[model samples]
Target: MTPRGVLGADELNNIAVFKAVSPSVVNITALGLERDFFSLNVQQVPQGTGTGFVWDTQGHVVTNFHVIQGASGARVTLADQSSYKAELVGAFPDRDIAVLKIPAPVAKFKPVTVGTSRDLQVGQKVYAIGNPFGLDQTLTTGIVSALNREIESVTHRTIKGAIQTDAAINPGNSGGPLLDSAGRLIGVNTAIYSPSGASAGIGFAIPVDEVNRIVPRLIRDGRMVRPSLGVTGGGPEINRALGLPKGVALVRVQRNGPAAKAGLKAFSRGDGGILAGDVITAVDGEPVETQDDMLTALERLQPGDSCTLSVWRSGATRKLTVTLAESDD
Candidate 1:
């Protein structure tokens, strides 16, 4: 008979991570109003389920925006089986991140230890704690498959610097913490590249560096402070259709806006046809091939910050300086 004693080093490490972080993880049940087809009456019903983690001892919970989207309200269940009603504090669909507040006591809100994603290496062991498929308190293990990957957000915007892992993130795992072996939060498990809506060994997470930047602003202002250059352009599809190189083509520049103020040219109607406008190829030496890239580049700066734009205009390329401004939206 095999003798049972202390666990192996790896087994012990995995168990230790689970024990430390599980208390911070919580299961979320979102409710929404639905109409009955026959009676034509609206009633509250269970909309969906997802996972979240405690952000602080103040009862603030962080989850994916889609988790509570279209739902009237939600409830958070802790590892101790204590449940509390959650109120939507703020949501930034561009990042698939949302903050919720519960009235639970501070003692019940054990915040997870945060970690930086900037130094993560491929093949490093990682952990994902969430309620996958509605199975609460489930833990999955995997290594960092890749880093600095780009994924689309719920708002159809690009989420840059995403950490790719094979951590078995499923439907219900959205918004849970993707932790390192030390049980520190490195990213928020968001989406999985699967046709069947399962893990499929490819999962993505929003890097904690960005979450660290956006969440505090959401908590304080209820919105992310995304500075804009005030230039109008289409997506990558329009850029490709126009036969232009990889860059955003300025269709119209807002008057008195940052782009206009910086003397950025806009498209003009000519005798032959519509004349091309200045195409922004890079921002502050960072190459931006698509509008998503431009937006991501601009996100690194704040309003009133000066940025240099490498623009192609009228068969000539030149650098233009622009001061960013707050988005009207």
Candidate 2:
């Protein structure tokens, strides 16, 4: 047999990346409860499987919220094939991200090097490490097929600014890390655009920028702490039926809440007919055409932040400053 010579630069880089980042990757098994038909005894069973990575030395493992959703329990297996019981720490379903903690010692963890996604360009080299089809420690390489893509979360919320890559992400790849050429974590593999539920050369990852923003909060608060204007708005159908402009039409405003305190009004029934109320057209000068748009606009804000809302009331546009408050939702 002929001996292979020196490896190419790209091949060496791939090998280096796989070696550097693979230790941070872990396999997740979701446990569910089942009942035996004969004895009617309840037992724990394997519900699903996915991939996750070590978040920090504190034994926090980050993965997609959908991976552990509805599971009675979960287990995490490190790169060395050592398994540990994981406890749900926190989750932000709107971004499809979740955090779990294991009692493993800090020496067993090698956290992935986090990277930013704001400057990612299309066609750049990327890699995905996951446990596809329950096969652990598999590495696939591809390029950034697109950027700033939108994908829906398990909660049906729009996760904007997603990184689209052709990295061969599969069913069990959920919550795995998508790394750059430098082996830095750039995104979290979440979904694929395939009709047959297999990789079709199109995969989506939650950008690391979003992950960086939400993970710490989840660790601290156990959920995404979003600010609210304290108003319930009508859906798109209601807006279309009423022939309203492209904005969030207020359906109900919480009494003495931020919006109500700012004099925002809600739709009311009168003897004549339904009375139109204030419609929020913008937040802090950013145009918001839908409720989701408004939420995205306020995503970066905190509970005590003050924002100017562009409101349409009685056919005239006006500006109202409202102090935001913590949202219960």
Which candidate wins on lDDT? 2
Cα lDDT tens digits for candidate 2, 152-220: 988888999999999899989999999999999999999999999999999999999989988998899
lDDT of 1 by residue, 1-329 (tens): 99899889999999999999999999999998889999999987888899999999999999999899889989888888888888888988999999999999888889999899999999999999996444458999999999999999878998989999998999899999999999999999999999999889999999999998889888997887778988887667766766776788887898899898888877667998767788899999999988888988887787889999999876788998898888877
Q: What TM-score against the true fold does each predicted structure earn?
A: 0.91, 0.93
Candidate 1 clashing pairs, residues 3+ apart or interchain: none
Off by over 4 Å in 1: 34-43, 132-136, 235-245, 272-276
Supply the TM-score for candidate 2: 0.93
Candidate 1, position 25, lDDT: 93
Worst lDDT run of 10 residues, candidate 2, spans: 130-139
Model 1: ten consecutive residues of lowest lDDT: 131-140
